[model samples]
Every structure is written in structure tokens, then in C-alpha cells.
Target: MLVLVGLLFPLLGCGGPKEIIVKGKVTYDGQPVDNGQIIFIPKGEGKVSAGPITNGEFNFAAPPGEMEVKITATKELAKAAKDGLPNYVSYIPKKYNDETSLTATVEDKAENTINFDLEK
Candidate 1:
């Protein structure tokens, strides 16, 4: 019975899912950005996940480790501007057509909170 109990202890010590909490805010012109998508691209891996934006804030959990990530924010609210015309209706530049990108690193057993300020 003692041997069996010792074996059970090792099983209980097994590691569970390792996760890292990532949180951040997005702002443009000093204003909270809403309805934008934040993408995380892991180093050497094509896996990606879209983080949702709520009230200019976002949070996500990823496997605990060092990771190279790129964040982006899209201008969804400014789609339709004056005269019911799309903001990028004509002469849209490649950079302005999508979200702005930033590169950052996530450390192990750490909570990373970052803020991205986009330009108009």
C-alpha cells in the first residue's frame, strides 16, 4: 500500500497546462480603440490566434514560454466617414488599409501588458 501511495504522489505532481496571461490596450489619437483584432504570431511557428477587443482592452492566455509576437489594430469604426463614403474609398495605401503592427516578446511565468498607439 505504501508503494502504491508513492506512485500516486508522482502522478499528482504532474505539470498541468502552462499558460501565460497577456493583456493590453489599444488607442489612437489618445482615444480608446474598439472593435479591432489583435494577432499573435509565435516565433518559428505559423500558429496564430485573434484576440478580441472590448472597450479598448484585450486579454489572452498562451502556452508559457518565450514567444515573439506581433500586434495589430484595425480601424473598423472609421470605415464610413463623411458623405457616407468609406475612409479608404480611393487611393488606399497598403499600410493604411490594415492594422498597424508591433513586435514584442512574452516571458515565461510573466504577465505582459502592453499598449499600442496607432497613427492616423
Candidate 2:
């Protein structure tokens, strides 16, 4: 019974969710962005969304192996822009505005960190 239990323990561990930590910071005009949304899109999978930037930092987790990740600022800024308000905000360029359009690959047991600096 002990031998069987020992064998089962390893199997059970294998069944658990793979933990891959993804972390990054967002900045604009040489300063950390205080608010925005960061999105991680895994290759061929749904997106994982993180934050309204807290201290200009964000973190996310996913299963190991190749994944595509895209980051973007919150729509509030864009809306403000449309409203004709002058505020210090970062806007997504014509490119990289679509989450599906951005893709990244993660290798096995990797901690990936990417930083994005938005344009004026």
C-alpha cells in the first residue's frame, strides 16, 4: 500500500495546474503608468487580464509553454482623448491595439517579464 501511495503522489502532482509567473511594468514619458490594463493572450487560448496598474506593476500566471501576450492601456484614456480632454495618458498605437493580434511564446519553466512604454 505504501508503494502504491508513493506512486500516486507523483501522479497527483503532475495533474495540478502548471504555474508560470509573468510579470511586467508599464511606463509613459519616463514615468510609471499609474492606471491601465495589461492583457496576456496565450497562443490559441483565451486572454488573461491584469490590472489598473498598482504602483506601475502587474503580475499574472499561466501554464507553462509557448503563449502569446499583448499589453494595452485602459479605454478610459482613449475615451478621454475622444472627449477632447488634455491629460497625461498613453494611447495604443494603430498597431498592437488588438489583443488577438499580439502573440508571445513562453518556454518550459520560464518567468517572463516584459515592459511597455507608451507613446504620447
Candidate 3:
């Protein structure tokens, strides 16, 4: 029916929100983070985005919103591994990852860049 077709036409054009590219840097104790990952959790109903932090920087596409960020970095202890003990060590403080208090607001725009300087 013509009426039915008209109603469905607009619905076809409706897609989800556009994801903006978000880029940033990460540091610990004034030094660049060697390697890690950054996660962005939306404050409201939305999808999450994540990216790897390599050499103190990372970039990923995320929906615009208020995001709670969590950053984690770790290293493997060669000595401990050879001794058959726990070999993994997390140099970053718990406050930056487990109990993260970091927040960033990303507006819907053409570009966004944020940086996190963490301390142990």
C-alpha cells in the first residue's frame, strides 16, 4: 500500500549514532607508558570502545558521551617466570584501573584528543 511504503521510508534512513575518532596519550610518573590498553565505558546506554596504548598513545572510534576511562599496564618478570613463580607485575596503581576515577567528556565533533598522566 502507498501509505505503508511512506511510513517505512523514513525508518530505513534511521541508523545509529556516528562514532567519532577519539585519540589520546597515557603516561605514568612523567614517563610514557610502554604498552597497555584503554577502555571507555559510556555513562548511559551505549556501546563501549577500546584501544591499545602503545608508546604512550592510543586511538579508537567511540560514540560521543561522558565516558569513564580505565587504563592498565603490566610487565612480565623474567626472573619470577624462570623460578616458576608469579611472573606478571602491574606497575600502575589500582586507582587508575581497578578503582579508576578518570573521566572524560567527548562531544560530538570532528576531532577529540585527551591525555592521561597517571602516578603509581
Candidate 4:
């Protein structure tokens, strides 16, 4: 019947898991991070999500689950790169990026607010 067909084909307006909207601010050594990137890596089987961080604020969508956070902020160097673009260096400690110890949870809610105050 039409009802059974509709249920069989999930592509036909079938409800599915939704992505949660997450917002937060980032600070380093008591100062707002001006420009950077924030990544939300799901601790389990989920998609990795990322967003741009500006003025210590950021917002992005992610699958609901436990997440590992990685923050990065770079400063422009005096010299230029081989591509002629301005060079930059990572100022945030590796503990906040490459080897991060920060974590957050994105639950099944309308929205979530998480903040991180980093230190050297």
C-alpha cells in the first residue's frame, strides 16, 4: 500500500538524525581570540564539524555526541610564504590544538553554549 511504500523509502521525507547548533567563545591567557578556527571532532562514529572563530566567538552545526575540541589562532609573520601570501604561525599552545585536552558535549537540544578559557 502507499503507507508501506512511504515507510520503506527513507528518502521520501523520512525523519533522520539532526545536527545540533553549537555556539561558544574562546579565550587565551585572559584575552579574546581575534581570529581562528574551531573543530568539533566527534568522539564516536560521527561527522567532523568545524567553524570559524572571530572575536572569541564561534557557532557551527554538529551531530549530537561527545566531542573533542581543537582551537587554533595564528599570527602573521613579517615575511611572506613561497606562494607570496602572508605567512603565519600558530600561537595557541599545542595542548589546545594538535594535542588538545579540551572536550565538550553536544546534546540533542535546540542549541548549546560552551566556552573555553585556555592557558599557556
Candidate 5:
């Protein structure tokens, strides 16, 4: 029984899923994006991760594998008001979000820099 207990100890203390750090920049029409959110959804079965875009940059830890990327940006809240209603508009095209055409491969111990240059 003592030997059995020792073998089970390692299994019981096993950690959870593996993850890696990812970072990149967002540019629109040749200039850095102002504000937005970036999301990474694993191609297979895995948890999704997100990061906030600030000054055209974003970074976060995510699972290591193939992931579909989605980006969304809009004008400032004060600048988006129209007809007394919040008219949040995205500067990025739908092909980069709902119909994302962006993909990235994340690996361990490597510089994971994924940059996107969008057009208006």
C-alpha cells in the first residue's frame, strides 16, 4: 500500500493545461490602432483568451496551438454618439472578427508576435 500511495502522488498533483504568452500590434491604414479588443479561440478544444488593445498593442497568455484571431476597434464613446444614441462602429472589417480570416500558431519558449494591418 505504501508503494501505491507514492505512485499516485504525482498524478494527484498534476497541474492544468499548458499556456504561452502572445503579443502583437494592430494597425489601420498604416497607422497604429487606438483602442480595441483581441481574442484568440483555439482551433480545437481549448479555452479562449482575450487582451485589450492600448496604443496599438495587446498581449496575453493563451493556450499553445492553432488559434483563430478576432479584432474589434471603434471610435471613442464621446465621438461615437449620434442622434442621442451610442453608435459604436468598428473600424475593422467583419472579415477580421465574425468571419475572421486571421490565424496564428502559438508555441512555447518563442517570440509570439502577431501583428495585423487593417485597411479602411
Candidate 6:
């Protein structure tokens, strides 16, 4: 019984969750995406992590698993709107943000770097 318990203990500990660090860079049309944010949404059940994209770089910590990545970058227009509201434009396509198709597999490691090259 003692030997069986020893084997089961290791199995139980292996099933526990692992921490991971996720980091990445985002580029659009061969240019760096400056001033925006990136979000990592766990596929099933896990916490979500988001970080600011500065100079086309972003880094954050997340759980080890599959994640749906969403990249959003916006730039202020030269002129404001008629209503005086700040006008902004998104460099990335809707598929990369609203309906993202990007998927990343995070693992237990010191650092995971993922880069995204987006299109219109």
C-alpha cells in the first residue's frame, strides 16, 4: 500500500497547474505596431492576461495552455470627427481583433515569445 501511495502522489502532483510567461511582438504590413494592446484569452477555463503594446513589443504572464490571441492597434487621425470626438483608426483587420484566428500554445517555461504578422 505504501508503494502504491508513493506512485499516486507523483501523478497527483503532475496534474497540478503550471505557471507560464507569455511575451510577443506584433507587426502590421511589415511595420511595427505601436500604441495598442494584446490580450490572451484562455481556450477553456483559465484567467485572461492583457498587456500594452509599446514599440511593437508586449510581455505578460499567463497560465500554460491554449490561448486565443487578440491584437488591437489604433492611431489617432489627423483631424477630429464632426462631433468633436477623437478620431482613431485601427491598423489591424477585423479578423485579427474582433474575430481573431490567432492561437498560441503556452507552456511552463521561463519565457515564451510569439510574433504576429497581420494583414489588412
lDDT of 6 by residue, 42-116 (tens): 999998888999999888788888999888989989999899999998878879879999999987688899898
What tens digits encode model 5's per-residue C-alpha lDDT throughout 1-109? 9999999999997778877888989998898888899999999899999999989999899989999999998874665465777767777889889998998888876
Q: In model 4, which regions exceed 4 Å deviation?
A: 1-4, 7-11, 78-85
User: On a 0 to 1 TM-score scale, where does candidate 2 land against the true structure?
Assistant: 0.57
Candidate 1, poorest ten consecutive residues by summed lDDT: 88-97
Name model 1 segments beyond 4 Å from true: 1-17, 64-101
49-79 per-residue lDDT for model 1 (tens digits): 4577777898987654444444444453465
Return the TM-score for each candidate structure: 0.57, 0.57, 0.86, 0.85, 0.83, 0.79
Query: Model 6 — which ten-residue stretch has the worst lDDT?
Result: 13-22
Ranking by TM-score: 3, 4, 5, 6, 1, 2
Of 4 and 5, the candidate ahead on TM-score is 4
Native RMSD of candidate 1 (Å): 5.7
lDDT of 1: 0.61
| Candidate 3, pairs of clashing residues | none
Residue 62 lDDT in candidate 5: 92
- Give the number of the best model, judged by TM-score: 3
lDDT of each: 0.61, 0.60, 0.89, 0.92, 0.87, 0.87
lDDT by residue (tens digit), candidate 4, 26-99: 99999999999999999978899999999999999988999999999988899999999999988999999999
Tens-place lDDT per residue, model 2, 33-72, is 6666666555565445444555678877765555555555
Model 1, residue 67: distance off in Å is 5.2
Model 2 misplaced stretches (Cα beyond 4 Å): 1-11, 45-52, 75-90, 99-101
Which scores higher on lDDT, 3 or 4?
A: 4
In candidate 6, how many clashes are counted? 0
